[model samples]
Target: MSDQPRSYLVLASQRSGSTLLVESLRTTGQAGEPQEFFQYLPSTSLAPQPREWFAGVDDENILRLLAPWKPGTPSMETPQEWRARILDAGRTPNGVWGGKLMWNQTPLLTAWADGLAGRQADDPDAGDLKTAIEDVLGPDVLLVHVARKDTVAQAVSMWRAVQTQVWRGRADPEVDARAEYNADGIAHLHAILEDQERQWARWFGEAGVEPLEIDYHELASDTTGQVARVLVALGLDPELAPPPALQRQGNDRSNDWIERYRAERISV
Candidate 1:
């Protein structure tokens, strides 16, 4: 039997079904809490964020440098709490815990320490995480990151989220995305996505971690099929029974109103 504890992460950006994917994973009784990795929501628009663990990283902001969540969310449980919850379920005999985090917070996550003997602030990408995984869980740890189309569409979905005041945990002060997403907003949004993608690609290439990339539209069109792809990548058959509490969304995605708004705003 493998001696390393089994753990994994789901990587994606905001407004890209990362949370919904988490919900799907939550169905596995013994899986784990769907963790939004990068907790700090950047108020300032910039490429490289405060690399607390990168080349200049010198402090203990492991979570801060990463997580981009509202600080005071009610349902926001600590990583340890999530781990304990899974352990309590007793379903994870191999100690497999699936946690998630977003890579869009790339500005911050480029530097993180898995609490091992060696330090790797220089190589803040897949290779470093793979190292940590090997030491603790061997090569069993998986790095799964999800990808969406582009900024224009992603902005539409994210904008809807801001307007509808979406929240998986405690609600934060509502943001008028209409006001937030203007001409300048569109420009910046594109920049952020591009920068994040660049870094993610580099990390994925150098880290030696196997990559799993999927489009959001593909997932929405066929939840069961797409999830099966994910499960297979995770080394399991995707055709598992659904959880009793799984709520199906009956909305038709064919009508993409928000996407229209994003396209219209491109000129202005």
Candidate 2:
């Protein structure tokens, strides 16, 4: 690849409908199709690993590209390689490409800054991911940060999901919050939610990366129009609309998670 057009990241808080947004953008083709692994973090990425628990991913070498900090994984090791991967994913083989993934820059950046200062953080995985973009995809990579209501409801919803998923024989990865909540007032969950949102918001403030802020209420209200707004912001032709190829899998349902969170907030 010629170090030309590449991909960008979508920074947002979890459960803020990021998956839905990415799906919508990719379908419209503003952002190129996300790697199949975009849904789940590929286990075998570089840097942070005690990953013995990871069996393997559906794509063998795909993890190599994603493990953006790996020593020899094309992108992480060589700027040229990283550029190539970006181009491969950014535009089409014919050169119409864009790539996007939801990322949390808070801890990711802290670890990176610490490493450059000659100290490693808990997660040694570090890479100047922005190097892979800069002027490639576009001057502005369209970092979008989303915010919703408070955390009491979020924690309740997450707890419920854990139970429901388990009952269905589909357990999510266990998180220590379960123990802490049972031990304490579940205030930890609220703290975590607020912490991450603040971290991300502060990141925008400190780093001078003014991301497009999308409120939960705005998107939920007008889906297509909001998507078009984003497309316009990204300089993608609004007339293009995302390629239908990236259409969402199912209709946006009752959104039990958001509804449950909201309802609980009222009750509280």
Candidate 3:
């Protein structure tokens, strides 16, 4: 392995099988632990909530709420310290670092990246998400864009997850609950996914980045092949054995929820 670390970003939207991909990549022990490293950042919001809920909340309270999501991160560390630690810890013995980020988390990432480069927090030049990423990762950082081809399914998944507060397995029991279907909410989520996809396409065009795109369906069907493809894209040895199987999270409940939402929309 080269002395200089190889870095990559897994750009994805919510409920897009990104977790599966990240877990698989991590199993290789070569791809690095590419998780939502910026998740604990103050401005990071995984779901929509009324602003009033956080009116009197300080950073400590926010960190407490974020504890369940961010593993291996101490609650006492400041955001800047957490950012630095995450980058260092994400690297594997093979000198490869990987990270996954959703489009909605871009603001927090941009701010962290700006600080890394010693750029002004509000600098327009520092505002470019791609540039900010490369500033810290390196100039030739590879990007893998993972998306769910079925917008309806993806939207339903996001809607259900937001309602249930169960984005993955082993979630807090206190937040575990069955999700209710909402036609308007599902439709809104679908629109948001479409807009986010378009935004990603636009950014790729502007940045001249031809990212390796992975479909959620294909990834589920052939995890090894997809992982190999990602390895090859990152100039790693593709012959490496696939990682151990990950515990599947979603189930028939998601499909049931989708059907319920579809029927509700039709009736309206």
For lDDT, the strongest prediction is: 3
Per-residue lDDT tens digits for candidate 3, residues 1-268, read 4533388889988888888888888888888878787665454433334222233434442323322432233355544676678778888887788998887678867877776667885677777887878766778777899988788889877765665566766445455453455566667678778877888888889988888899988888888899999888777888763853575556676678777776776455
Question: Using TM-score as the measure, which candidate wins?
Answer: 3
Candidate 3 shows a clash count of 0
Mind giving the per-residue lDDT tens digits that candidate 2 earns over 1-268?
A: 3443334456654445555566667776445664422222223333232121122433433222222233323224233444456467655443445444334333433333344434443434343344323433445455666666645544543343322222112233452222112212223344555676777666567657776777755765555666676667655666655432222211122144435445544454
| CA RMSD (A), model 3 | 6.0
Model 1 lDDT tens row, 1-268: 2543346667766656566666666565434544554454333322323232133333343223232433332334443453344334423443556655556453333322232334444544433545533443345655667777755666544433433344344223343222233333333445565666677777788866566666766665665566665555555546751432233221233125444555666565
lDDT of 3 at 256: 81
The CA lDDT of each predicted structure is: 0.49, 0.45, 0.72
Tell me the alpha-carbon RMSD of every candidate: 8.8, 10.2, 6.0
Runs in model 1 deviating more than 4 A are 1-5, 37-94, 106-129, 132-138, 160-181, 235-237, 241-268
Q: Is candidate 1 or candidate 3 better by TM-score?
A: 3
Q: Number of backbone collisions per candidate, in order?
A: 12, 16, 0
Candidate 1 global CA lDDT score: 0.49
Alpha carbon lDDT of residue 235, candidate 2? 57
